[model samples]
Target: MLLINGKVLIHNGEGLNFVKADIRINSSTIKELGEKLTPLPDEECIDLNGDYVLPGMVNSHYHSYTNILKGTSFGEPLEMWSLDTVALGRILGEREMALSVSLGICDMLRSGVTACLDHIPHLATSHIAAKTYKNTGFKSAIAPMLHNVSDREILYEINEIYPVNGKHNKFPSVKDYVDYYIDFINRFHDPKGNVKVILGINSPQRANDELMKAASELACRFNLSIHCHLLETRWQRLSADNDISPLFKLDKFGLLKEQTSLAHCIWMNEDELDLIAERKAAVVSNPTSNAFLGSGIFPLKQYIKRNIKIALGSDGVNCGTSNNMMDILRFLLLLQRTQEMDYTQWISIEKGLQMITKNGFDVLGFDKPFGEIKPNHSADLAIIDKNSFLDILDDSFLNQMVFNASISAKHVLIDGRFVMKDGKISVIDEEGLRREISAIKPYLGKNMRKALNIANEEKKIYKSVYESLLISPSNIQ
Candidate 1:
């Protein structure tokens, strides 16, 4: 495959330089990238018509099936009144899971993201989503989440709480889940290749100490990145009962490390900041989701000063906003400025762009193949319609990109194969996905309606359950 005749933004602020270059690939690796080379007469040529060709965007953290939750919740915190994840959990079979992942990836791809760290809760079906990348050729770092809070029985007693919507089915043990993930890593992680697995947990608030320790141990043993959600909600913060704060508790349990990557460190105070920077862990900042959930603003300036590697994520833009990683960047940009009331405190375009593109690949622990477009790197890239926006050019590329170039990222490639081209997907039937998604929505709606009704009934039944159980309603308050 050859990506020819497009404006190339090699890396953030490498200062736009023009090139009449050719990007050549064989099998999966980028065979060559430099000035125009005469092709073997048989090589196919793609005319960019002056578009911007760059390394595809990388999503550091995202939920595969969470796209269904977009637009439904106006302003709910992470803990309450949010549409049920369990609802989506009930109706998604392997097919629905694959389509959801495909939809999410395609959304990213079209918006210029070529890679992601997907947080999937169901292992078997999560594998199906990862497999879509193999078929579609997008890069992915998958972490099947393990969330079972057995040790918080005291909290369960004190607060008389259950999982939101109470949708846990057949809990898998920590070791068993770790064993399953290890098998996934063994099968998927390609240190010398592209698609891989990261050791993962859903959140500290939702996981037991055993799982947390096991997750870190497995990630260390395999030398893969550890991914998790941290401080996502106020109630989650309030749930901590011991002297050990959740951040330091993981540290005490030997979980924090250079290889750990946490999503939504929104509520971390100064101490947690020091711990994260000290350990050299990475964070994926989902500004859009943070805004949507009304989770407090993450301390971006604090993290930046400490030299923490931060990446950007859409967080199933459905749950957050839209899947355009650029929007995540834009919102982060405006929000940072607005919250600080100082423009300089805002993460600049150059730095903010790196979060979505380069830093994410760095966080994934794949230094060579994913982010920058260089010789021997995997051919994962996106081509944008440079002329699509007003005043678009190399001169205005950066400005246009961060501010306007977001949705203009119309075409994408992974491993040198055309996954999307000319503002349309290359491999999968975009319409077919829509058809499957449409066909699936009603079944999901029916099942969710049923489950929600049952859950509502359970909530009614349990109204006095907490009262009788010696847990005060004000505890939840």
Candidate 2:
């Protein structure tokens, strides 16, 4: 396939530059890039009609289950929000899980995201989510979470603040979790295919020694990458008992390595930051989700100074605003600026763009080079109609796309195949998907109401704990 007459965004030695080039794709990789390239007699050709082509963006951290739960929750802290999400997750069977995954894919492709690290929280329906991604030909690293601790145990002083009479819910045993992962890996773990399986630790404080050890061994044996939540809130940071840092705990289990990507390192100290940089691990910052949950801001300046690879994520759609990487990038660029006083030290548009694109691919640890529109790179490109957003094209077009424009891909390709073309998704029957979702709305509505009621009761028990921590003195710097 030959794509001609397009303004392609390419990274020169200095920075990203736009060049008028024709891209030649052979199978799943880009073969050549040049101007006025002629097409072969038997080759299919697509005229981009002077559109702007970009490397496909990636949603570094996301929860596919939350796609159906959008608009279901007002803003709440991470711990409190989890109550509602957990309840809702319990009601979703295989059918609901598939539709939810499909819905997230449709939302992501419309906004030019071609890949993601889907950190699934539910173990029962995780295979459903993975199969959905596989069938749609979407690139994803499906991570079924592992954590035996209850929510109350991970929050600092929550038990003390609101004492419970009986024991908390029993989680699956370490052996159970490990066996499940092994079976899941054997069934769906495909490093060379569209879907891959990675180890998902819910959080360090939440996992016991046995589980962490198993996770480390599994990762080592399978050569899998690790993705998990890390210190997203002050209460979570305080949950590290006996002055032991969460990073140290992870390292003790041999889980902190280059292939590890921790999400939401917002409440970390300089020592933790240095440790992450030294270990060559990556951190995914979800700006919109942090702000929405009232979690502390990520130390972007500190992370950048440490030379840690930082990528962007949208997080859960219900917690954050949108699945759109462009929206996330825009929010991140603007939000990070408020943290730095020096204008010169603020993140540049180029750096922000990299976070949503190449940095994400780095975090996923895919062997084949992607997130670039160059020869030998994976042909995952988003052909966008810049004219839809920009009336007049100029040098500031990229800037406008980041800050002012409403961005959507006119055509999206993943692995040299069109998943979305001419503003319509090609891999799935979107109209049928909408109808399925609509057909179940009444059932969903009834269940969601019950879930909210359950969440409210749970929230009452934890509300005082949340308030108490807000006024407590902090030792963390």
Candidate 3:
């Protein structure tokens, strides 16, 4: 296939530049790129008609289960918000799970995101989510969550405030979790294919010694990448026992390696940051979700100074503001700038673009190279219609894209095939999917009300304990 007459964005060592060029795709990779390239006799030709082409963006961290639960939360801290999400997640059957995954895919594709890391929290319907991505031909790394510790156990001084009763909810054994992962990997894991399985430990504090050891073994056995949540809240940072950092604990289990990508390191200290940089691990930051939940700002400047790979993600849409990667990137750049007094030290638009594209590919650890428009690179591209209102200069195109424009893809390609063409998704029956969701609206609404009630009741049980922690002195200090 030959794509002609487009302004293609390419990274030219120092920064990004748009050049008028034609791309020749052979199978799943770009075979050639140059100005006015002649098409082969039998090659399929596509005229982009002066559109702007970009390397497909990636969402390094996301939870697809909450795609259907947007606007369900007014506002709450991360610990409190988990109650509502956990309640709602329990009521979703296979049908709801499939629809939810499809909904997230549609939103992402329209906004030019070609891949994502779906860090799934529920294990029962995780396969359904995997199959949905596979059938739709979407690029994804599905990480089914693993942890046995109850929520109450991970909070500092919570046990002192409310004595531990033997009434905590039962979880699957370590053997059960390991067996499930092995089966899931054998059935769906494909490192070289569009879909892959990753080892997802919920958090260091949330997993016991046995489970952590099992997770490390599974990751090494399958050669899978590790994805886990880290210190996202002040209370979580204080939860560490004996002044030991969670990063060290993970390292002890052999889980903190080059392939590990930790999400939301907002509460990390200098030593932890240095350790991450030394180990060459990546950090996936969800800026919007952090602000929505009142979590502190991520130390972006510190991470950049350490030369750690940083990628952007729109965490659960129920907590985040949007699914668009551009919006996420823009919000991150603006928020990070507020922390820096020197204008020259602020992150540039080019770095922000790299965070959404190149850094994400590094975090996913895919076999083939992605997020580039070079020869032999994956032919994952987003063709966007140039905005007449913002296309005043070649140099200012990226600036307008990051700050002022509401970017959407006119055509989207994954592995040299059109998943979305002419602003319509081609891989799935989007209209049919919407109708199915509408048909179940009444059922969803009823269950949602019940779930909210359950969440409220659960929240009441821990409200006083949470308040006590808020007023308590810092355990870390």
lDDT for each of the candidates? 0.71, 0.88, 0.88
Q: Which runs in model 1 stand beyond 4 Å of their true positions? A: 11-22, 31-44, 72-74, 81-83, 150-170, 241-243, 392-394, 455-477
lDDT of model 2 at position 218: 93
RMSD of 3: 1.6
User: If both were scored by lDDT, which would come out higher, candidate 2 or candidate 3?
Assistant: 3
Writing each residue's lDDT as its tens digit, candidate 1 over 118-212 gives 88877867778777877776777888887786322323342456554245435787778887887888777775556778777776656767777
Best by lDDT: 3
| Candidate structures ordered by lDDT, highest first | 3, 2, 1
Candidate with the larger lDDT of 1 and 3: 3
In candidate 2, which residue pairs get closer than 3 Å at backbone N, Cα or C atoms, i.e. clash?
Answer: none
Task: Write down the worst ten-residue block by lDDT for model 1.
Answer: 150-159
Give per-residue CA lDDT, model 2, range 1-477, as digits (tens): 999999899876767877789999999999999999999999999999889999999999999999999988799988898898898888888888899999999999999999999999889989898888889888998889999877575567875553443366568989999899999999999878788898999888778888999999999999999999998987778777444677888999989989999999999877899999999999999989999999978888888899999998999999857989988989888887777778898788888899988899888766677888889888999888957656465567788789988788999999999999999899989999999999999998899999899888988878778887778787764
Instruction: Count backbone clashes in candidate 2.
Output: 0
Inter-residue clash pairs, candidate 3 = none
Better of 1 and 2 by lDDT: 2
For candidate 2, the per-residue lDDT at 34 reads 94
Write down the TM-score of every candidate.
0.87, 0.97, 0.97
Q: Write the per-residue lDDT of candidate 3 for residues 59-89, one digit (tens) a residue.
A: 9999999999999998888888889998999
